[model samples]
Target: MEMFLYYIHLFARNVKRTPLFFALVILTLSIGIGTLLANLSMLSLMSTDPIPGKSEQIFNVNMNTYAGANNRFGSMHVLRYSDAKAILDSKVANNATMHYSSMVYSRRADSQDLTRYASPTRATTASFFEVMGAQFAHGEPWKNEHSNNIVIGHELNVKLFGGANSVGEKLELQGKIYTIVGVLKPWEMRPLFYHASEGKAFDKTDDIFVPIEVAIDNNWAVFARTMSTDSYTTLDQTRQINAYYIQVFVELLDDKQHLAFQTFIDGYANQLKEKGNHRHEVDNRLYNVNEWLDKNEVVNKDLLAFTIATGLFLLVCIFNANSLMLSRYQASQFEANLRRAVGASKKQVFFQGVVESIILGIICALLSFVLAFSLLALYRQLFDELAPVAELPLHMLVIGLGVALTSSLLSTVYPLIQGTRTSLASILK
Candidate 1:
């Protein structure tokens, strides 16, 4: 430990001798590392499983139940209200829920402010909380599916009630009053699997979740894609019409449950076929969380391509840094020879260089963070659509540090070897 400290002290003295060279090395390394880290941070966030252990157990339901051959999306993964309700009522899976995206102007019912904020809402069933593993900070999911009770997400809770326990509080939406049955804890799910369509996969969780029956009865406007052969006048007509807009998710505990649920969906598809509802053959499919994200292509392809490009750029940076390190070591060769003449071994000289590289790595890591933040801000401006999901998580932060340290050490290897290998007498002359 004492020798290690002494080596670090020697490293500091070395840096003091050529501060410009040291700064240049760190700046060069930080630029490359920071650019790569920014891309990696967004990619990692996008690819992360929203629900870890239960991801495999939960699946997104997709069935080819649409009547038209020229489907806009070419995939009949979305469900009609009737079909969605039927599946939800089946109770075949351990837990199942169906939902559609809706938006409403909302405010606290008791507040003096008449202003209403446009809130992203979900018209879902009570099982949604259980299926999605959403935890409540106060109260619980509404027991009455037809009642006016609703659940508010943490962000909404913060906005309206100042982040306090908001249960039993009344919320007004479009001139209607609804009781808040639950207040969600801080829940953030990236690549929101339930409604991954229409470029909403990376969107935050809904501000409000209301019972599907209540949402329909109250005529909440659908904020999502609704396809129907017959035009619907109101949300209430959605149940009776063949309008396809809802999305369904179910939790099947094991392969047996998954198979059974698949079989059930197939039977239902056949029923639709027999009834002249569906024109095509039964093509019901269930995708696990990760599979669903892949199907949606939630992680942008351009981001992946950019990540690869940045990786190559980092290699180029390493080469440039190695060349700079070689030049710095060559200049210090006389000093290394003098130390060897005073009884310092080659191994000792090499160890000191390694310690110096590690110190440089630490400095590089700090500078890389500042550079990464600047690059990420630029990225948010360039890619506004992805701005919300661009921030770094703890794991990505640690990864950035590891990449910096590894890069610095890698660039020093050849330079450190050459610096220690030359004959002492020849270098001194």
Candidate 2:
């Protein structure tokens, strides 16, 4: 109890001598560490699917090659309806989903408010929702029997009919009127595969989705072909869909089952090639469950780099704090010698120095928390336009506190040892 009081007195005296330097060291260290943690949190949230399902079992199947008179560079790897039917009928995959893209036009009650712009719209099967782990915010997705039904995104509903409950209402798409069957939740816009080829971010803000059958009957193969002069014919087409853009996702029982499924797909692709059905050749690149977890390599690399840099920066701050503490000890040389001469033991001096460092560390941690929160609030306000609803998770706060405490202890070690080594005889002369 008596030793504790002495240590407290020593800490208070040291802090009173150098408040500004202490605050600077804490602020710099906190900012560097806090920013790194915030970025890591964001990356983690974005790369994960919110739905509770086996997302790893899902695979994107594509036909990667085509045979023609001349090798074409940008030829599509899509299969036709017949080819998809054959694959699905074989039950080689756990589930098969077909998709196609088209330009959809829609309008509101007021023709003036109506927009007729080209949007990359999708025509997909009902299993698409299940495969991608999407849910309806209001109403349900279209049934297999409902050919003329449509489901719109939340933002699209607002733009077309100005309400969320636009279900059962009629909307015109591609010069055809269809009843709105469902409206998807905001986050359901994930796994936008179309943007993969376009090299752009898929904003689910404004897109119209409809049944695959309706799209095929109404939009697919509805192109005009113009013939040229001479015996050789030239075809000028507006939209020609020669193949089907379908992806088959499978959910196997175990690792062995997964490998078996991949081998089956490989064998199937070879069979298609042998049969000259090269357009339906399956791309055997299977993504297993573990691979999905580590999909965001860029994000992972960025987070790691940020963490390493932050750790280094904090180390530099600690070294600076230690240097400052050393200089202060040098100035108190006479005082330390006087105390030692008065019969204070080396252990007593060492304990007092450690206690002083502990007090300074606690003060720095509290100040750092305040500064980190302030910086995060500012960041949120500034980037509200870009990531309006993004936030740092609660776990990051715990991590930040751990980092601060650890940094404090490491920084104080050298200074505490140096302060304990002062000699009474050399200083008292």
Candidate 3:
């Protein structure tokens, strides 16, 4: 501790001699680290698996069951209601859920309030809450088979009921009174992996979760794509073999279960082929959560390109910082020789240089964090498409500091060696 303090004192004295040189080095590194950190924060948010514990266990099912000349929907991930029902009935995996999204305008029933709010809704089965690992702050999912029961998210809870536990309350939607059975906690799922292909990955989860049967029975207007081979006049006609829409996810607990589930889906496809429902050969694909995100291109390509570009810029900053460090140390060569003549060791000189670089690195890290915030705001304002994933998390602050410290240490190596090796006789002569 005393050695570090002494070295730090020596470093402080050197900075006083050439403050501008040190400032320039730190500023150079700050810009590079700042840009890299900003992009890295967004990239990490997009690529990270929202459901960490069971991501590997969950799999998305895709099949080539479309038998039409158009082939618009190449790999049919979204299935018709009939196809979804068939998969649910098979029950070959540990757990699975089929769902499609919609948007609805809802208002409180039997209330004096005159405002109606537009909310995103999820039409899914009971297993959806379990499969997606939803946590509840009040009430729970419906116990019986009824479409009148609904689940509301935290945002909706705040909007409609002033953030109260509105479980037993009634909501009026589409000229119907529905009972709220559950209220969710403040939950955030990045790249909402379950529906990444729908372009709502970075968006918040639905405001309401209702039964798929009720949604099917009433024919909820399909806000998303309802791909079909045959001309369908209504959403109710989506149950036909020619139409495909709902997305499916299954949970396989072990390798045995995975293999069995794969075989089951493939066989189901083959059976459809045999029955002449599907003309294509058996072609089915399954992707785990992380794999699904990659397959669907969830991360912004422009953000990734920015990350790579900023990474190269950081390298350039490192080179420039190194040159500055060499010049600073070169100016102190005579002092270093005199100190050596006065019995100072090479290790002492080296430690002093190291201490200075580390302090500069620490300063750079702090400054870079501020720059990162500004850059993130600028990027979001410049590109509205990447706004959802632009914010930085706490962990990223540690990463920025680590990078700054490491970069500074690396940049000072050659300079430290050069300064510490100056001969005493050369200076005395």
Best by TM-score: 1
User: Candidate 1 clash total?
Assistant: 0
Off by over 4 Å in 2: 1-16, 38-53, 68-86, 100-112, 115-121, 155-164, 188-207, 216-248, 256-260, 279-283, 289-311, 325-398, 413-429
Computed on alpha carbons, the lDDT of every model, listed in order, comes to 0.88, 0.58, 0.86
Best by lDDT: 1
Report the lDDT tens digits of candidate 2 across residue range 184-254: 77654332332223222223423667776677667442121211111221111212323334434455646
Using all chains and alpha carbons, the TM-scores for the candidates as numbered come to: 0.96, 0.65, 0.94
Worst 10 residues of 1 by lDDT: 68-77
What is residue 119's positional error in candidate 2, in angstroms?
A: 6.8
Compared with the true structure, the alpha-carbon lDDT of candidate 1 equals 0.88
lDDT of 3 by residue, 212-277 (tens): 878766778766766777887667667765777789999999999999988988888788888898
lDDT of 1 by residue, 293-381 (tens): 99889899999999999999999989999999999889888998898899889898888888988888888888888887888888888
Error of 1 at 214 (Å): 1.1
Clashes of 2: 1
lDDT of 2 at 250: 50
* Predicted structure 2: lDDT: 0.58
Of the candidates numbered 1 and 3, which has the greater lDDT value? 1
